[model samples]
Target chain A: MYRTLVGIGLICALVIVTVFEVTFPIIKVNKQRALENAIYQVLANTKSFSAYHLVGNNNLQKVTDNDTSDIYACYDANHSLIGFAIAAQGMGYQDTIALLYGYSIRSESIQGLVVLQSRETPGLGSKIESRAFLDNFNNIEIGLDAIDNERQQPLELIKNNSKTHTRQIDAITGATISSRAVVVILNRSLSFWLPIVAKQQEPIT
Target chain B: MSTKPGEIIVTGPKDTDEFIKGVWAQNPVFVQVLGMCPTLAVTNTASNALVMGLATAFVLLMSNVLVSSLRHAVPKQVRIASYVAIIATFVTAVDYIIQAVSLEVHKSLGAYVSLIVVNCLILGRAEAFASKNNLKRSIYDALGMGVGFTLALLCLGVVRELLGNGTFFNLSVLPGNFQPWVIMLLPGGAFFVLALWMLLINRLKQGGPRD
Candidate 1:
């Protein structure tokens, strides 16, 4: 039994390790490219991007990989900051929806939204990634006064095409939970990240 | 092996029943009702179901091949653990391959891809058939079961996607005014469809209570 067990263990390890080694580089490149594309997409007109990590409450330091929140700063062709792309995740109808959105400091508005990952039901909640649903993020001023660490008004979820208020976002007809999830996640992410971003506001140029 | 035509023949007349048995008689989904979790969960869309079916079949084939190849070396006492380890290696490999292939497919499959390791159908075959049979027969058995499983998933996927969303593989198939049966996309919808498929298949194979 011991010999058989050991032999099996060795074989399993060898096979798994071989497959993992061969595929790891390809998987890494795929994920890295996807994230870069998402950042560029959310922050439209972005030519290049850099990621910054929060250090000791307020200090912004450049990082390659981080477990804690790392905000990506997107720059235009002139190397001027266009906006910041922040990733946030929250529970949707079936699973957690991970998304990246661009927030413009100069205009105090959200630029765009892109779903990084979502496992919602097809033809329903998955519509969150639909172009029509995502278009809701185009140029809605959040009135962010990062100096005070607060948003002038909280984002609201309204019926599709019932956008009478500037703060109201239209939820997909059949994907209410999944649509609202984006709003709720953005709200939480903004509250947490905007303050930290404010501390080192300068030198971002 | 190269000179003999029979060596590589997939569906030779002599052993054609070996393949047909699993495709019809002992089907993993429609007849045996094995791996109900994926059958019920991922069949909401035709594309999702097709990709999932192919992925599962890939894993089944690889695991069966390995298990059959190593049958003699794996002692009876620790056979279950050995089989699980072999199965898990392939599942992880499949998961990574799928992710590398398309993040969309990876996200759609979600955790179900990882959950393939625990599938009763794969393990049951490993223990019952692959362990005892030679590689050739084992390969045939796996191919038959894999095709049967994929066909079953496609059946459920087509029915659900058509009635629930009025679309087949995300393409609109019905007129604009067709109101979809919303419940067909939910968990209850899967049970309704599976029960109906079972009733239909049972009626065709009528011979009293199924053994």
Candidate 2:
């Protein structure tokens, strides 16, 4: 009995390892493609992108090396800088909601948004991906003044169709918690990266 | 001895009976009522249901083949462990294949793919049918069960998707003014749909002429 169990264990391990070895590379490539696609999807009309890492807590510094969690600077066909795509995550209705959003340097507003991963409840909280919810981000202002430290309330989520201000997002009817979560994630992520992005916009020596 | 040492005595049902029983008479989902987890979770959309059904079928087929091939070697006492290990191997393979094939489906199905490891249908078939049958007969039985399971999921997926989202396979089926029943898209809706299907099948069976 002992010998049989040991033999079965070895065989199962061998089979699992063999399969993992064969498919690991393919899986890696697929993941890379997916990330790149998400970046391009959020930053529309982009021909290429360059990754930059963020360092420091308060005074953030951007580095070209890919050592840490990084953001992408997207360029159009003419090689002109279009925007930056940054990944952000925060607590949602059921679990963490991770996403990517395109930020326009010139306009200082979010261009688009794409949810990378989410564990929100289906049918209700999952409406975060719906066009009606995402359309609110199109050129919506995220000016530095909206940060909590400053006078303005950071990125407010209003009732559906009640978005009278540029900084306000319309919440899905039955997904109030999820909608608020998105706003909170965007606000936190934007507050941390906004200064660094502004510094990058300046002409270097 | 009365029987020759290598001579096999077939005490189970005929090969055709084994194959046909799974499709309707002993349907894994409806009759045996096995693998309810996936039956409820991934049947929200027709496409999700179809992909999940195919994935489950692949796992069931491979596990059945391997189990039947090794049935003689596995000891009676540890047979359950051996069957589980075998089923897990096939589930892992199917999960990776699905991820590589279509990330969207993989994402929608999510943890349910891994949950296939625990699905009673595959293990039940392994012990009840595959272990007692030869390789060819086991394959036939697996195919029938897989097809039956797929058909059952499709039944629920069609009704749920049509009512919940006002669409079939993501295409608009209901008129513009039609309001989708939001509850049909929730977890409760899965139970309601499956219950209705089982009731319908039961009523049909009872109403039909006696076999």
| RMSD to truth, every model | 4.6, 6.3
User: Chain B TM-score for each model?
Assistant: 0.90, 0.90
Instruction: Write model 2 residue lDDT over A9-52, tens digit each, in one string.
Output: 78777877887877777776777788788888777788887776
Q: Flag regions of model 2 displaced more than 4 Å.
A: A1-14, A58-70, A78-80, A144-151, A200-205, B1-13, B208-211
- The model with the greatest TM-score is 1
Please write out the lDDT profile of model 1 over residues A65-174, one tens digit for every residue.
73344588878899888778888898888778888999887787788989988878766887898898888888877655642544343678999488997668898887
CAPRI-style docking class of model 1 based on DockQ: medium
Models 1 onward score TM values of: 0.89, 0.88
Which one wins on lDDT? 1
| Worst ten in a row by lDDT for model 2 chain B | B1-10
**How much DockQ does model 2 earn?**
0.50
Say which docking band candidate 2 falls in: medium
TM-score of chain A of 1: 0.87
Q: What are the iRMS values of all candidates? A: 1.9, 1.9
Tens-place lDDT per residue, model 1, B1-211, is 0112223454666445556667778889988889999999888888888988888888889888989999998889888998999889889888988887887788777789999999999999899989998888888788888888888888888999899989998899899898888778876899999899888888767856767
